[model samples]
Target chain A: MTDALLRIEGVSKRFGGVIASDNISLEIRPGELHAVIGPNGAGKTTLIGQLMGEIGPDSGKVVFEGNDITVLPTWQRGQLGLARSFQITSLFLNFTALDNVALAVQARSGHSFHFWRDARRLPELRVPARDALARVGLAGREDVVVSNMSHGEHRQIEIAMALAMQPRMLLLDEPMAGMGPEESARLVETLRELKQELTILLIEHDMEAVFALADRISVLVYGRVIASGAPEHIRSNAEVRRAYLGDGKKKAAGGHG
Target chain B: MKTIFTVRNVLVFGLLAFLAVIPAYADVTGNTFIMTLFTRIVILAIAAVSLNLIMSYGGMVSFGHAAYLGIGGYAVGILAFEGINSGFVQWPVAMIACGLFALVTGALSLRTRGVYFIMITLAFAQMIYYVGVSLDRYGADDGLTIYKRSNFGSLINLSNKTTFYYVCLVTLFATMYLVWRLVNSRFGMVIQGARSNDRRMRAIGIPTFRYRLVCFVIAGMMCGLAGILLANQADFVSPATMHWTRSGDLIVMAVLGGMGSVIGPVVGAVALLVLEETLPHIIAVVGHFVTGLEMTAAREYWQLVLGPMLLLVVLYARGGIDGLLRGGRRD
Candidate 1:
């Protein structure tokens, strides 16, 4: 019970001459919504990419469920119950909203080689897919093609996909980007509900949502974490203000909260 | 409800009916040319359908699909030369050879993307084509002739044109049905998602490459079956069966029909071959009537018309003939 669901121990990633994730260490306990926020180029996405097994860290290791998963490929990491949503609204556009989530549910289910019957009619797949869509407020839009949906809706579908996996840990990158206030509010509610069930590491630029949802906040700057503390402490910290909050132009240029 | 005909459903039903009726028509007409032409179309359609599994659904544009055709054809050719003419033996050998080739090629080619993937697959197929050309014992560049069609041991007399046509038709329908099941399955969903956005799939814990490789193998195996049928139809096999240009022809059949829909390739096969058969006659008539031009010269220039037709399809009819038939609808 005490073991962290995901632990990044001195994990660092370098892209060419640039350091994307500087020897950073973080631990996420169960049922915690830890938000990693930073200006642009902060390596928050890269760090998540490393943890999700999409990108390998140049040095150090990532341990998930007491297993060193630094060398594991992205799909293998998924099999171990680590799920992530993209910063970009990446989804299967041709699929109906339900079908997109159904695939995630399929990944977690038994082998997908069951070729004879239609997967869409199967209760095992469709039931979980419908539940996931309902969780993300897309119950009515399950039949809608994802490409025809709005950007905000696509983001929700992405979240629904991650949720459908029934993952032990969730890594979400900028889940609220490109959303209107109403959509953001809805997503916040969905995240709040999800936080109670799954361990979440959220990277978001929406300050209000970040402060509202994250139990702990880690501020990343130029591929390094300059500050990590309680959200209240981060909100009032002078160094954070000087380096990030105080510079409106810099923050705007660097991107979101 | 008007039953809301989708391009997919229409193509599927249309192909099935056409395949079902072809043998009966051949039985009545006694024109074996129609059966032979349809057999060629159906065999190629199998290749196109198999390719659709990866190219359209998986978003992998492999220019080397013809390589499987070569492998399958050569398998039958070499085996028949060695005094083995069993359809059962030749078909499995063809399938295994293509599957193995596809596995190795897919593994290497999957490491790349976009045009690079296309080029790598083409290169691998070309390698096989040249290898076939070098096998002097099996006729090499000259080609090998099989004296007899595959021996099915009295259950089906493939020597009978109608029987062979039905066999090709049945195989085509089976291949189409299998692909349809595959695309709608959970595995199919992953492959399609991987095609649409691979980065997103990987982010969601789906390892897309391995799934794609498996898909590549399945497609190759299907194409290999088409190759065996093709050898039976022609009673010969050669490097020309697997030439890179022939691969391009398969792509044309796929694109000309529509890439995504299961039966689009069949429609393309039927349309392309029908045009090839009739266009020369029509052109010769026009040439002789309009300007007193020789029929022989016009026949040799049929490709000029086909070249422009493909260009038009690429430019204006991006969805292919199926799109036109469905009135601008897409699958």
Candidate 2:
């Protein structure tokens, strides 16, 4: 729809004989959390890559705020307020948590051609970076080097980096991929608060978090979106249950309450 | 700032003071050869520092860095041969030439990664080396000699060995200061981020390639300045100046010194060159004492000792000498 903040229209991608994305069309509305649920090898990550401009779609248009940005470079897309967190936890391991988030803030400030001023000493970058870290419950851990931090804490830093950019929408690929239950719960709580202000497209295997936080759920199977609608509609959709959510029904039900 | 009195700072200050007084010490001892050797060390240290900018921070391992040294040297040599000897004109020409070479080669070479990048850079340097060989008018492989040093009007005397040594020392410190400022700046953040993860850097709204190319050009220009000093120091230029082995030596200097910090490469250049100067005599004495071998024969096998030492440093001291001094602390 024209009101949709991000719209993917019939995007398809092929890798040799494998179809990574097969006519995948979806929409993310403003201030809404959209969760895409899929089985392993369902090309969920490929979808995120296409939207983030890392992978080219064979046939389709990606419209953001009614602008066709299908072929824009990844950084230009990011400049247009589209941000992403890696599924495999990519971070500047040598840098401190505050330094990592400040880099994200620096990316959005302008062209970083500054060659003399110490970037780490800037209050403008540090203040927002601190606020984002505190929002993710990592207030006191800012000075910890990322390589030394726990895996769950790295995920939180990932989110803090995305938030520091003040992005219009976030494409998060498995933000809770390696997190424990306690960390998952903490992240779910953070997302609940964030959903009030930001648009998010979440690709997660955790059904409980998906059912609890998603305003609308889309079920993808083998690069195809089988169903997309309200959470209740997706839960009852027979095809979605048969293709992807069969074993997750109990967890989804528990989360809904 | 309170950590300024740390062991590393003290050692660094001690080294700087030692360098500053080398000419005075030579004057007292009448051992002018020491001044000449130290001047070469200081000039090459600037090149090593430039290499560290791309290798350590930008994660670009160029194997053809010596090509810039040759380019800068040849810029002076060729101009001096043509009867143009002004430092102002010759120096800028050398820097611009090196920058242009870097831009063209970097555009093609950066398209590949890992060993491919290394090989491409090596190939380009070899190509330049061959071009140097083909310049028969400039003495080709026999090399070209500059009859006079670059003329700076009333500025300073390059003919004075002591004055030239001071100039090289000043330039090394300035290069280190510039690199320190660059790596801490906003531009440096983007460069380091790209080095850590190029994909993530692009996703985070940094047009990484352009920034990296610019970095490559800056490093080339800096190394070119070192080349100018080296040509002036020796008053000669040859194709061998940018030989692949020379490139390898620059890489060794960076690795040996500690690429993580600005001063590490300077330490590395001094250490490697000084070891090269003294290791043969040390080997001869040790060999004569241990196994009763003839001193000259033992000196011939000096590399046998140096090889294992380098291996030990690579294996045990992964961060090089600078890392060893820091005791595993991050720079």
Candidate 3:
């Protein structure tokens, strides 16, 4: 547990009548892609939010690198090496892709109070931004404004932003949400390459990517983790099958069998 | 790098050149009124530039920016009334006072978004306005007359009208240059990022509130400089200087010019002020020709013509006049 990069212990959050995160507890070890797979409204995003310090838990703690970060603000969590990408493409729509990644680099570099120097011309920031963009296979599209880019590119930019921070762990909320098959495959490969170096808590609906890339998988259902184990273990678990994957497979079989 | 030969750049530079030569033009034509009008335009352009920093780049729509103008003016007026007429003392005091007020109000106001943010800023400005109204010792509601302009000693002569106009014109250019550096700098990038998406800014590890608050204070102090110039120009300070409507005019100037660029607000200030001054006479002439209405009566409704013009600019030119000059590019 002490070796875990992030620990969510007994985290519970309620929105009036409905519970968003009910007694959710999970751990992400160093250098592992731990994916949280769930159906819509299954508290997966809420769990990610709690880990990223955006939402407060009703009762529990989010321990990051052995520090209790339950009361820390979102930016502090980021400073402590926890970065997140939103489920919805949250970006500076007017700025270029290079500018977006460069901002992430700027956040990690130091205070941004340097008022006179042109930030775009800073090689210290631009170099890393370029490297991150290249890592995401977006080499030549650096100057494209975010709003002008496709939805899939926005998703890639989100990942590139997280990668640019060089965080200890990444909390990705549906990175492949609206991606085409080719884009998703590319992302899966990127995540595979990434998991070899960095810790990732991936909240994704793409079952193929989740099953293929996750070293460990947790099945969240109605605000609770019904199963937590290796991907093969989660795939064969009867409760998880009945709750999520099995139900989907049954519907597919009925429609096409 | 983008070419500097674009239409917007040409217009901006041309306007600067025109401002620089206005005093000579007035001297040649024996038209002192032209100099005075241009001076006011230059001073208000500084205020508009400051407003654009927060409104356009930082995404903070403050409805009480004129409060700083009032504060800055009062700092000068009150100091002069108390017999401290030194420019060195008055200007810094005005800037500091404006910064403090912005810090306090911005701390509270920035917590709210959209309409609430607008209302809180308006409320704070109104509070300052009433305070200005209640300063019974310094001419209260009617306002205080500055008997003498802040003495700059051997640095410059404030008594010379042409000298003062040049002084204001220089300040306007300096302020624009300062804002230009700010928006393109690291600090500016953070502020712009916050404006584009504040939540994403925090998610990426930049504590955005503090950056925004700093930006707000910077804007306040810059506008305060304009206030100092305004008071010196009019030789008067009143509660009306910080009135909410003045704040609205600043917003209009920024929006009308083009909030996207640093010089956009200056253009807006020039366009708005010039239209305000000329619209009545133009309206009177047009009305006389078309409707046979009395020139005086027609002139009273110049705002009717101005309102539709502003609406057209807002609807058709999303970036304002500067945006149009940039060939309709959004940013």
Scored against the true structure, residue A126 in model 2 reaches a CA lDDT of: 96
Instruction: Candidate 2: give its CA RMSD in angstroms.
Output: 2.5
Q: B1-331, model 1: which lDDT tens digit per residue?
A: 5465866567667667877788788778887678777888888989888988889888889999999988988888899899998887878888999899999999999999999999999999989989998999999899999888888787788888777887887898899899999988878888888888887777666778888889989999999999988988899998999888888888888899887588778888888888888888888998899988677668777878888998898788777877776676655
User: By DockQ thresholds, what CAPRI class is model 2?
Assistant: high
Candidate 1 ranges with C-alpha deviation above 4 Å: A252-257, B2-19, B23-30, B288-296
lDDT of 2 by residue, A62-174 (tens): 99999999999999999999999888889999999999999999999999988999999999999999999999999999999899999999999999999999999998888
Model 2 DockQ vs. reference: 0.85
Q: How much of the true A–B contact set does each candidate keep?
A: 0.72, 0.84, 0.89
Ranking by lDDT: 2, 3, 1
Give TM per candidate.
Answer: 0.94, 0.97, 0.97
lDDT of 2 by residue, B204-263 (tens): 898999999999999999999999999999999999999999999999999998888999
Residue B110, model 1, lDDT = 94
Clashing residue pairs found in predicted model 1 = A40-A254, A205-A257
Sorting all predicted structures by TM-score, with the top scorer first, yields 2, 3, 1
Report the candidate with higher TM-score, 1 versus 3. Answer: 3
On DockQ, the stronger of 1 and 2 is 2
Lowest-scoring 10 consecutive residues by lDDT in candidate 1 chain A? A248-257
Q: List the DockQ of the predictions in order.
A: 0.69, 0.85, 0.88
Task: List candidate 3 segments past 4 Å from native.
Answer: A249-257, B1-3, B291-294
